[model samples]
Target chain A: MIGVNSSPPLPIDYLYNFAKELFIHSGYVYFPLLFDPDVEKELKASGLCSRQHVEIENSSSNILLRDRESWFVKGMSLESFVSSYEKLAPESYNQHLEALYKELPFLSSIDDNPITDKLCTIILEILPYFVSKNRRHERKKLTRDEVLELVSEKLNIPPVLPEHARRILNIEKLRVALNSLSKARPTCSKLPSGIVSKTEFEHWFSESLKAEIIKNERRKIKRSIASREKFARINEKVLAVLFFAAEKGSLEIEGFGFFATEHEGEFIIYKRTGEYALKDYYGRIYMFPDCRVAIRTNGTLDPFVIENYKHPFLQKHAPGQKICMRNTLLPSTFTAQNAIFAIQEGISALLYGYKYRKRNGYHSLDSIPMPGSTVTFDDYMVPKDHPRILRGEVLVTNEFR
Target chain B: MNLLDKIKKAREKGKASIGVNSLNTVIAIIEAYSLDSNFLRFLDASPYLIVERKNTGSRFTRKPDLRIPIFPLTSRRNYLLAKQVIEAIGNPYIRFSRAPEEVYLSKFLYRENPSISHDELRNYHFEILLRREIDKKKSKNRFQ
Candidate 1:
């Protein structure tokens, strides 16, 4: 039978409670077991008394129980004994034990021979600097040559190396250099083709070409105005016909009663009791004023009518019969009443008869009709048998000898 | 005749006319019965049988034949009688001249229970079952 260890130094509850409290404070699910003879002896010497027992048994369970109290106490002081752990168990100690366990092959190789230990020592010495150089390379943007120089200086390695390794190390740097150069000097093919140089194109567009366009536009406007003036002249001609027709009853000028040599397609007309030169075209006659009246009638009255007219010539030359007035000489304010008034005034002037009398007892001035009165001519009383007409006919029949 | 005897006599006389097609008369009878049970009970106890007849031989067979049945107030007789009462109540609201039997059953016996057949269940029993089913469905959908 197994005898119980030395009065069971720490009660099971106390040990379990202490372990639980430590576990809770550390927030660890599992903690390592620590049991060292020297550490236990030191603890005992220090007067931190704790019971200890030794047991040898066939099963691992008995051994674990025999050292349980010691392991707990030592494990509790693990932080303090960290340096002493190597001295206590130098052969089994390893700082990277967890890593070595994870990488079993590496641990096995290192454990197998001294050669691997030497290799690991060399790798450890250079690995940190190489890692730092690689980290710097990744962080900073540098040219390929710059990166190569930095790597060589940092790792204390020879700068001269295989071209492939150099390229591999500076691949990102090479790409960055190529990208920057491409942006700075873009390929000619990438620019727009068939384009003039910038300065020449801008000079042509702004100064010479723009001035030419403006000059051409002004010429076009002048040409348009010239054509418009021509069109207006034609339009005035068309409208002139209507204006003439509206003023005169007919286009014939003979109805205006003027005696003159009858040119072919032309005639003289008396307008406003003044002789006018007239010309006919296409069965229509146009008249122009040739004389001014001595006795002026009111300008607002129709100038067409000689109000005092009682002459046979005047009766024959009534408006719409042989000749008519264009009435252009009449004032713009002339209305139908003014026309009637002018006719009355003219007839009054003619009826009073001009103050000239012939020595033959025949009136020198022709008798004129009064306003609101009709003048009837007796065809028999006219001078068909007149002695003056016979003398004129005789003279016209005889030769000029 | 006694109440059962009168029902029997009415049934025999072919007077158990359940006009499922005419719901108004059925509803009127039901309402009348509800208003005054004595009057309906007296009518139920009467010996007159109201039997609907199919047209076959004559155009003048418009009136239902009044006769008496041998048995009265049995389950089968009560079912036919209840059906007649339901038809009498429901006929007026229906527009068409002819109505399906299911419409009568659905209105009177089924009430709110979408399940259950009026022909298979007694009127009073179906009424209670249908009310409970309707109440249960109502409670379930109350929140929604």
Candidate 2:
């Protein structure tokens, strides 16, 4: 039966599992190829593992060469492994795989082959050194010619063999897969602190949206607001907030609480009076209100977000939304009075529809019906001519700074 | 160098390249066109127009030499003017090759318009999708 659950341990299975274990530990997937010198001629004639001059190193080359050919597979060559394995019967291969899981405790539960494929690719790029018991070597992949040259120089043989090209892993694809894996893990953070910059916050934010792990009820929230396109908006909003906060040494996310500083590379979230803890891009958790400020928990208030941008304010202000006009004014700087004024202005604008406008070249004002009372903030005095402050452009200032 | 020469040199050097300010202008224009397609025609006819940044508490003025002015999109009229300038330069987002800058500008566009693909930073379908969104909105409004 192809079912691994009921399978018994087989010798081939042990070998297969050993190879997979090597792949997991060393980041390389390889198979053990046994080449007996007695059948070397016949094996070469059969055209399996077809590329390469195996060097027999000995002072007496002629005597050693006459002996049966003995070669072992110690390096990576996916094509060669596949070609060699193809000669094995399907039943045998399947049994071997079953046996492999039975023997290898760590991988015994893993049913997916794609993870192995992913590891193989990563090994190619960040391949570790070919270490010897006595010395350490630089990590590198040798081309067929280079290998052939080295072998030839060691044994003084002519080079004439076609070696398979090393398997190449797409770094971009690997990166994406790794990101997804981090998102899936409960306690892993995709973006750790100390890696993001002010300028890079937006990109990191986008990546975090795709990589942040969510659990139980939060996943439901994600689905409910699925049409709102919260991912892009939340990331953008958070990055903007974080950047501003970083600059000002502290900032408050209007409806959300205040944050004192931003951690270098982290996108954090603090759940406010909710059952679920806020999870950042890196699976770090911070409960709301109690630890709203920075603490020693996995969550840091240095760079904070409101429930990691799942809040209504972040989700609701996208284009085509009624509240889109509400975000017309820049976030106010954090002076106590300015904060209060900013909040008042924001509410007033939303309630009475005080629209933002660009100044035209003409000094003359165009009259539009004004619905709200005159609103002014920090040092931008109302003109006497425009008393009651109705029906003219309201210029924004850098009062927050 | 004279002020004009210095400004000319800066433009020539491409130092005054499009930024978030320019991006918001394009969004307002597209939004205006979505409200009314006649805005597109109005934009095509206008000689020169102003572009503005969101009021994020920064001091930004429309440089006199720049054809596009940096201002806030407070009214339907501003969006109309914004639409004119946006059409002048095919796609403002296209100019930035770097992913960070592109993400900053396009994230809003991508979320607002579902047709834009998130898998690729530079999707050729952006302009097409934008047009589709405008058409969809216009059609929806007609029924209302």
Best by TM-score: 2
- Give the runs in model 1 whose Cα sits over 4 Å from its true position: A1-240, A244-252, A257-333, A351-401, B1-144
Model 2 lDDT tens row, B71-123: 33233334444444445444434322222222233433444464544443243
Q: List candidate 2 stretches off by more than 4 Å.
A: A1-31, A34-54, A57-70, A75-313, A316-401, B1-144
lDDT of candidate 1 over A246-339, digit per residue (tens) = 2232232212222212332221222343322111111111122222111122233333333332232234424322112223243433333333
- Which docking class does model 2 fall in? incorrect
lDDT of 1 at A331: 40
Scoring only the second chain, what is candidate 2's TM-score? Answer: 0.24
Q: TM-score per model for chain B alone?
A: 0.26, 0.24
TM-score of 1: 0.12
